[model samples]
Every structure is written in C-alpha cells, then in structure tokens.
Target: MFDGMVKIVLAGPVGAGKTTTLRSLSDDEPVSTEMPLTDGPMGEKTTTTVALDFSTVMLDDGTPLQMFGLPGQDHFAHMRPIILQGALGVIVLLAADQPDILTMCSEWLDAIQSITPDTPIAIGITRSDQARDFRMDALRALLAERKTTLPVFTIDARDREQAQQLVRALVYSFA
Candidate 1:
C-alpha cells in the first residue's frame, strides 16, 4: 500500500464533464459547489460549478487520492490556483464536440502549466461519442507545439473504468 495522499486537479471548459468524471471515480459522495446556471450558452444543463468539486478515492494500492475539480467558467478562473495548490498532477478534460477545442485545451494547459510547471498532466477527451470527426491529431499537434508530450485518452466521463484510467495515467506519469 502506498503511503500518504495524492492530490490531483481536474480542469476544463464549461460542460466538459469535470464533475461527472469526479463522481465516477470517487469512493464517497463528491462535494460540489454547483449552483443554477443563470447565464452562458449552456443548453439543457441548468447548474454550473461556482467554486469546486471535492472527492476522495483510494487506489488499488491503498493510496488515498484527493480529487479536486476546478470551476470551468472563466469568471471562476481565479479559483484555479487555489484549488490546484500542492496538486501532484492535473487532468484536463475537453468535450470532443466543442468547436473551440484547441483553444480551450491550450488555455487550460497554459493555466495549469503556469502554476505548476512540473506537474504531470493527462488529457481526456470527453463526449467522443458525440463528435463525428474528432481530431486527436489536432490535439497532439498542439501539445507538440508546446514542446510537451503527455498521455491523451478518449473517455466517457460517466464511465467509472474510463475515469479511473485517466487517474491511473496521471499517477503513472509521476513514475
């Protein structure tokens, strides 16, 4: 069994499934600071995470993991660093169907890297099933352009197995 807890931050644009991913991986009830969405173009979804989401999960090796999901909306961007404090790694989620996927990815990556330059990062492309022409190449090229190469996975945020895989990848990157 591994000793101590590892903190990981999950960040992405609004509606990228950060909360859903946490819920999938958490062993306990996840605490979320979600409130009804009053603005923005988020269709169908009524609530938004105003602060953060917190959850805990124990790995197979008994390492307790503290998972924190950052609020995706730009107005809450200030909370990113606060939530990311002392995190061992970061998981960036992007909806495959988003028209601005590249930009969104770049923005989140920049923010995380700026705060924790050496922190391992894993990118998870969510909503792949809804994207007809999902372009992994584009994302890879973006990472390459930034002079960084990291594990990128296509995942369904609501799938426990997929979400766990993301967490595993982030942990393994620390090796």
Candidate 2:
C-alpha cells in the first residue's frame, strides 16, 4: 500500500549513532557526511555531519524510503521543521549511557509533535551491549511520560541485521 515515497528522519543527540544507523539501513554504503564543521561542539572531528545526511531503501512492498538523518546538535535543531515537512515517521536514536538522552528524546518529541502529531516515532537505545542492560519497563515509562506512544528497544548500531530488524519493526507497525 506504500506507493509514494516515505520520508523518514532519524533524530537524536550527538553520539547517539544517527550517522551509523543511516549507514546501516540504506542499500548503498549509506552516503558519508556532507558539510564540514567550522566551529561547533563537535569540535574538529575528522567526521562531522554539518547539514543533513540522506540515504534510501525499498520497502517489501516496493515503497521507497527517503531516509534523512539530522545532525544531533542543538545548532542543527532548526533544520528539523524543514526536514520533517513531509516525513512519514522518525527513528529517534538514544544512547542510554548518555544521561542527556532523556532530554534529547523530550526535545525531539516536542519538535516532531508540532509537525505531525500522529507521525510514528520509535526509539532505539543504542550501545546496550556496552553498558548494563536497563529495564524495558523503565524505558517505556520514560517515553510514556513524554506522551510518546511508541515501541522502544535496545539496539546495536554496528550489527546490520539487528539494526535493520528494528527499523523493520517500526515500518511494520505503520502497516
């Protein structure tokens, strides 16, 4: 039933693995960073996603996904409204180890809610394998307090299959 292209934005805080997630799902090698950082919290990292990064993939029903990833920084927050203009949904990446993740999720939820209240939003808790596994109930409760009713799961960004499955779950929910 997904005929026309679906634009999906991946939003999260810095080091939440937004870039890595974009790299994993696309058919291609998932294009590299576009713009360079002049002066930002990102500092002078060799790899910095300044503007927005994009990649695409076909759904099982032949629908095209115009996957767009936004730089996970307050400086880049301005781009969300524009990038989310026609987005079908969003994949919000969150690194549990980072204490600021809850704040990041809250901010993004507020931003995206204004654009599309019904827009499907899924949270991916990255780096679960690195840190002690947190309770899924606690994670769900956190999201519930923000008024976001969506599935939240732990994910390893490095594993292509696991990452793809998480995305697939989100897509399937839309159906």
Candidate 3:
C-alpha cells in the first residue's frame, strides 16, 4: 500500500446498488448527497443521490481509500467528470438481469477513460442470489462482448463481509 490514500468511484445504472455498496464497505454508515426523486411514475416522495455518496476505508498498511458513488440518472451525468477527478480506479455495479448493463458499462468506460484509461476496474454482479433464471457463464460472455475484462463476482450489498471482499479485490488490482 502507498503512504497516501487512493480514491475510487462506484458507478452503474439505476437500482444497481450504489447506495448499498457504499453502506457495506465504509467503516461507519456512509454519508450521502440526496435529492428528491420527483419525476417519472413514482411520486415526489422518492429521494435519490444528486451529488455523490462518499466513504473511506483504511487498508492494513494504513492507506485510505475514498470511495464515491455517482448518481445513476442521466440528469446527473454532468457531474461524472468532476466526481472521477483524483480517482485511482472504479468499481462498476451491474444487475445481471438488466439486459442493458453492457450499454451502461460502455458509457462509464467512455466517461472515465480519459481520466484513467488503465485504471483497475471491478464489476459487481449485484442481485446474483436472486437471479435464479440466469447463468453466470452467460453473464461473463455478455461482459466480454464489451471488450472489458472486469473481474465479475457476486456481491450482496447488505452483507458487509461480501462487500468488503469485493472492494479488497478492486483495491488489489491497483496495489
């Protein structure tokens, strides 16, 4: 580990578990920047991440990682470039059931490529436990079609242990 901290970002589509991922890895409950979700079929009661969700984790060598989660909606896309600033890498979350997860991945890849082209990336295959009808092999093949070799694995955002392991792997890619 290095002497200073490494910053990482978590990005994905709506319902891909960005909030849950932040909650799972942070030493304490993650702090988020929320805005009201007042559009679409849902009424004005829903709140979404408007800015970013940030948390820090300390490695065994005392190096800290600042993890940030970007807002999933297109309205928040303008902030993507700023949020990725100073980031060491990214962990992209994807729901296995979402057929368009690949498109989301491509968008994220394009958005971050200029900042850190070779940045280590880890893909968290969220909702794997509930994806009863899909095969993991098929999911891997789908990812391969995008020209990305992200290390994909099951992650339960509610489980701290599982989430921590996934973050560790993402960090190790850069360590």
In terms of lDDT, the best-performing candidate is 1
Candidate 3 C-alpha lDDT tens digits along 1-175: 7865578899887678888888888887778987766664332226778888998888788788788999888888888888877778788887766766666667766777766677777878787776676466765776678676667777887788887777678767853
TM-score of each: 0.92, 0.82, 0.82
Residue 75 CA displacement from its true place in model 3, Å:
1.7
**Candidate 2: clashing pairs of residues:** none
Candidate 1 local lDDT, 20-120, one digit each (tens): 99999888879999998887447667788899999987768877878999999899989988878788889999999999999999999899989888999
What TM-score number comes out for model 2? 0.82
Better model by TM-score: candidate 2 vs candidate 3 = 2
- Candidate 2 per-residue lDDT, tens place, 78-121, comes to 88888888787788888877765666677878888888777788
Of 1 and 3, the candidate ahead on TM-score is: 1
Which candidate leads the pack in TM-score?
1
Runs in model 3 deviating more than 4 A are: 1-5, 40-45, 60-62
Give the Å shift of residue 42 in candidate 3: 6.7
Query: For model 3, what is the error of residue 47's alpha carbon versus the real structure, in angstroms, after optimal superposition?
Result: 2.8
- Candidate 1 TM-score to native: 0.92
Q: After the best TM-score superposition of candidate 1, give how far the Cα of residue 141 lies from its true spot, in angstroms.
A: 0.8
